[model samples]
Target: MAGAAATGGSARSDTYASARNWLLLPSWAVLCIFVLAPVAMMLVYSFLTKEFRGGVIWEFTLAAYDQFFFDRGLFGDEPARIDWTYILIFWRSIWQAGLATFLALLIGFPTAYFIATRPAQTRTVWVFLITIPYWVNLLIRTVSMKFLLRDQGPLNDFLLATGLIDDPVRIINTNAAVQIGLFYSYLPFMVLPIYASVERYNFALSEAAADLYASKWTTLRRIVIPSVRPGIIAGCILVFVPSLGAFLAPDLLGGAKNFMIGSLIEEQFKGNAGNWPFGAAASMILLTLVLVILMFLARQQARADREATS
Candidate 1:
C-alpha cells in the first residue's frame, strides 16, 4: 500500500510540472520572438557586408567593427589607424549622461524627500503635480523647451527686461542646453525611485538619531542615505542609461552640432549614409554596453540581498 501511494504521489508531481511548463510556453515564446530574435538578427547582420544603400549582403566580414575601431579613409583603402572620432562621440555621450544623472540626483533627492515628508493625503497631490509636465508628448515638450530657451524667448527677454544681462544668453544650441533637457526629461525617473525608498523608511530611526544628538546633516549622511542607497543607485542607472542613447534632446537642443551615439546610428540607417551593417554593429555595441551596466547592477543587488538576509 505504501509503495503504491508513493508512486501515485510521484505521478501527481510529474503531472503538475508538465502543466506548469505548458503554461510557461507562451511567455517564453513571446520573449524569444520579441527580444531574443531581434538581438540575434542584429548580431547576424552586424557581421554581414553592407549593400550600397540600405540592405545587407550575405558575405561575412569584420568590416563593420573594423570601421568602428580603425579609420578607413574616404575610399576604404587607407592604412588602419585608431579611430578617435567615434570614440570621442561615445565619450561625449557618456559625459553628458553622467552629468544629467548627477543633476537629477541633486534635484530629485530633495524633491522626493519633500514629497515623502508631506502629509500622506497631500503627497498624492504633489506627485500628481510633478507628473503633469511629463504627461505631454516628449517631442512637444522638447520643442516647447527649445522655444522657451531660445535667445529671444521669454526666459532671456524677461532677464533682459530685468536688467540682469546686456545680451541674451546663448542657451538654445549648446551642450548646456542638452544637459538641461536630459535633466528635465529624466528627473521623474530619479525622483520616483528615491521616493519609493524614502516612503518606506523608518521615521523612528531618524528620531532616535536626533535624540542621540546627531545633527541633521550627520543623520542624513550616516543613517538615511545608507538606508535609501539602493533607490539612489537605481535612479542613477535609470536616468543615465536612457540619457546615454538620447537623440531627440541632443538633436533639438544641441542643434545636431554633435552626434550622440544614437544620432550616429540613426544617420547610418536613415540619412544618406545608409550603412545598415554599421548601424547594426553600433546598435550591438550599445546593447553590449547596456548589458554590462545591468550585469554589474545585478551583481551588486545580489550581494546586497545576501548581506540583508545574512
Candidate 2:
C-alpha cells in the first residue's frame, strides 16, 4: 500500500511538469517561426544573386556586396569604383532623421515631464490624448497632412485670408515639409518613452536640488534630466531609425526633390530601375548603419545604467 501511494505521487508530479512544458512550447515555436526565421532568410538573401528575371538565383555571389561598398567602373572595369550616391543618400537620411529626433525630443521631453508629474487620474487622460492618433493608420495620418498643407489647402487659404503672404508659399514639397512630416510622424515615439522614464523619475531628488539653492534650469539639468536619460535615449532610437527609412511622408509631402535612401530602394525594387540585387545590397547597407547606431546607443545606455546603479 505504501509503495503504491509513493508511485502515484511521482506519476502526478511528472504529469504536471510535462503539462507545464507543453503549455510553453507554442509560444517558443511561434517566436522561432515568425521572427527568427525571417531574419535568417534576410541574412541569406543578402548574399544571393538577383537574376535578370524577377527571381533570385541560388548561386552565391559577392558582387552585390561589392557594389554596396565600391561602385563598378562606368565601363565595368576590374577595379570597382566608389558609389558616392549611396553615401549621399545615407548622409541625407541621417541628417533628416537627426533633425526630426532633436525636434521631437525638445517638444516631447517637457510634455512627458508634465504628464508624469500630474495626478494619476490626469495622467491617464493625458496619456490617452497623446496616443489617440496612433489608433489611426500611419499612412492615413500622413496622407491627411497633405490636405492641410497643399497649395490651396486650408493652412495656405487661412494665411492668404489673413494677408500673411502675398501668395501661397510653396510649403508642401520642400525640405521644410519633410521636417514637418517627420516631426508629426515621430512625435508619439518620443513622448511615450519619455513618459515612461519621467514617471520613474525621483521626485525627492528634484526637491533636494531645489533646497540646495539650484535654479530651475540647474535642477532640471542636474536632477531631472539624468534620472530620465533612459527615456530620452529610447525616444531618440524610436524616432531616428524609422525616420531614416521614411518613404511615404517624404514622397507625398516633399515630392521627388528630397529623395531619401528609402525612396531610392523602392525605386530599385518597383520602378523602372528593377535591380533587386542593388536594392537588397542597399537595404543591407542601411541595416548595417542602423545596427551601428543601435550598438552605440546600447553602449551608452549600459554605461548610464551602470552609473545610475552605482
Candidate 3:
C-alpha cells in the first residue's frame, strides 16, 4: 500500500511538470518569433547597402560600412558630413542618456529613501503618488511640457511678473528642455528599483558602521551605497537606455536641430526621404549597443551580489 501511494504522488508531480511546460511553450515560441526574429533581420540588414533609387540591395557590399567609418566632408561643403552617422548618433545618445541617468539617480535616491523608510501603510500612498503620473500617455505628458516651457508659457510669465528676468529664458527648443523631458519621463523608472532596494535594506548595517565611529558620509558611502548598488544599477539602466533611444520627448520639447538616434531612425522610416536600409543599420547598431551595456550591467550586478554574500 505504501509503494502504491508513492507511485501515485510521483505520477501527479510528472503531470504537473508536463502541464507547466505546455503552458510555457507557446509564450516562448512567440518571444522567439517576434523578438529574436526581428533582431536577426536587423543584423542581416546592417550588412546590406542602400540602393540609390530605393530599398536595400541584396548584393553584398562594404560601401555603407566604409562610408560610415572613414569618410568625412569638409566644413561648409555638404555641412561637414561625417560618414559614420551611426557612431555620432551613438555618442550623442549616450551623452544625453548619461546626463538623464545621473539626474534621475540624484533625485530618485532621496525620494526613494524617504518613501522606503515610511510605515507600511504610508509607503503605499507615497509609492502610488510617485507612479500615478506614469499612467498618463508618454506623448501627452511630453507635449504638455511644451505648454509650460514655451516663451509665452506660464513659467515665463511668472518669472516676468515676479521681476525675476527682463526676458523669457530659452527653456524650450534646446538640449536643456530635452534633458528636462528625459528626467521627468524616466524619473519613475529610477525610483521604483531604488524604493524596492531601500525597503529591503537592513538598517543594522549602517548602525553597526556608526558604532565603529564611521561618519555619516562614510556610513553612506561604505554601507548604504554598497547595499543598494543593485538598485542603482537597475535605475541607471532604466533611465539611460530609454533616454538614449527616446524620441517623442526630444521631438516635442526641443528644436529640430537637436536630433538623436531615435529621431534619426524615425526620419529614415517615416520622414521626407525614408531610407529603410539606413534605418535598419542604425537600429541594429543601437540594439547591439544596448545588449553590450546590459551584459556589463549583469556582470557588475553578479559581482556585487557575490561580494555581498562573501
The candidate maximizing lDDT is 1
TM-score of each predicted structure versus truth? 0.95, 0.87, 0.86
lDDT of 2 at 302: 85
lDDT of 2 by residue, 100-189 (tens): 999999999999998998999999999999999889888898899988899999999999999989799888989888889999998989
Off by over 4 Å in 1: 305-310
Please report the TM-score between candidate 3 and the true structure: 0.86
Note the Cα lDDT for every prediction shown.
0.90, 0.86, 0.86
Task: Show model 2 residue runs off by greater than 4 Å.
Answer: 1-24
Question: Local error of candidate 3 at 186, Å?
Answer: 0.5
Position 1, candidate 2: lDDT: 100
- What is the Å distance of residue 258 in model 1 from its true position? 2.4
Name the lDDT of candidate 2.
0.86
